[model samples]
Target: ALYYDNGTFFTKDLPKFQPYEQQANFEYEERFKRTEGKAPSGSARKCHFCLHRLNAGMLPACVTTCPCGAMYFGDKNNPKGLAMQLLAFNRGIRLKVSQGTEPRVYYLTSEVGTADNLKACLACHGA
Candidate 1:
């Protein structure tokens, strides 16, 4: 996510960028070496959680656009909302537990690529 901080731009993208890009390139090279090693087709665009839409009570475009029905969005305050329910029922994990930024987006622990232990999606007690 990008944020304004007194003439500076900050985002989690910087840490994630190089590793992911290099990994993608490595996979592509291994796949296409016999055919002249063309880079894999992928979008490197970064996305901030859509604050505008969230403020307007609508889900982010990516959530709605997910073709596999993998994304869920709802008011965290509503204990009955699907998102809240998921958070309650499933063990959600932060993308990076070590940083302790207390991320809002979390993955179900059952999900193969989730973190080990992290606080609530909203940093329940406090930041």
Candidate 2:
């Protein structure tokens, strides 16, 4: 489930969309060892929520580097956490709810006017 949500499957051959050379750089090697260890080619790769930083009592880079202060990360089970408070206050919604994936990420959206407006937006986005 975690892989499906945030993983990227890399191939030796270039991909069709936004193709780029899959070369071994310093960061690539470091991240590979840090996350998916000893995986074969074409395996899924994803950051494991920066486990090294978490173990060192630091927040993930995404949450720390968010310039707008829109991202929050913490224990979801903690009632006093800012993430939970924002979720409750904004009535956050998870994507693909019918799929039963139970995604860990939550999104907050602003009012898009009437139901007709929402339908139009979804239709345009092919949601």
Candidate 3:
């Protein structure tokens, strides 16, 4: 199951393009940022969006914990070419494409008007 999968909360560098203003809430946190100790504090991963954020060539915590191998992450650019392939596979269906904050994490299928999948993922991830 997908966890911490919110388009807004769990991805790396959001695209910085026009009409896609980044929401303040989706801003990344630093690894060393102080948390307020709330059950759902937003500061835990602020570092995820820092200018220095980059793929370490390993899975993130949730990805590593996934038993079903449903999640995949990699460069949309470069020799990886995985993202290009995915886009080709889903040419017509819509994703969360307008967030201006282009999240590197993408959901493979369409969840166009349904919050169920997104909610389920968040609950699974404890977000």
Per TM-score, the best of the predicted structures is 2
Q: lDDT at 109 for candidate 1?
A: 58
TM-score of 3: 0.39
- Local error of candidate 1 at 45, Å? 7.8
lDDT of 2 at 80: 97
Clashes of each: 0, 0, 7
lDDT of 3 by residue, 1-127 (tens): 1123342322224453223223223233423322223213342343352243334345555555665454554566754476567565653334567867555656676546336655666666766
In model 2, the number of clashes is 0
List pairs with backbone clashes in candidate 1.
none
- Tens digits of per-residue lDDT for model 2, 1-127: 0133334434324444232223332333253321322342235555567677787799988878755455689788898988788677775788888899778888765564446545655654557
What would the per-residue lDDT of candidate 1 be over residues 9-112, giving only the tens digit for each residue?
A: 23334544333333422232233111112223332323456666666678888788765456687777899988888889778777876788767777765554
Give me the runs in candidate 3 sitting further than 4 Å from their true place: 1-56, 91-99, 110-127
lDDT of 1 at 57: 79
Model 2, position 34, has a per-residue lDDT of 18
The CA lDDT at 59 in model 1 is 83
Per-residue lDDT value at 99 in model 2: 96
| CA lDDT for candidate 3 | 0.45
* Candidate 2 Cα errors over 4 Å, as ranges: 1-43, 111-127
The candidate, 2 or 3, that scores higher on lDDT is 2
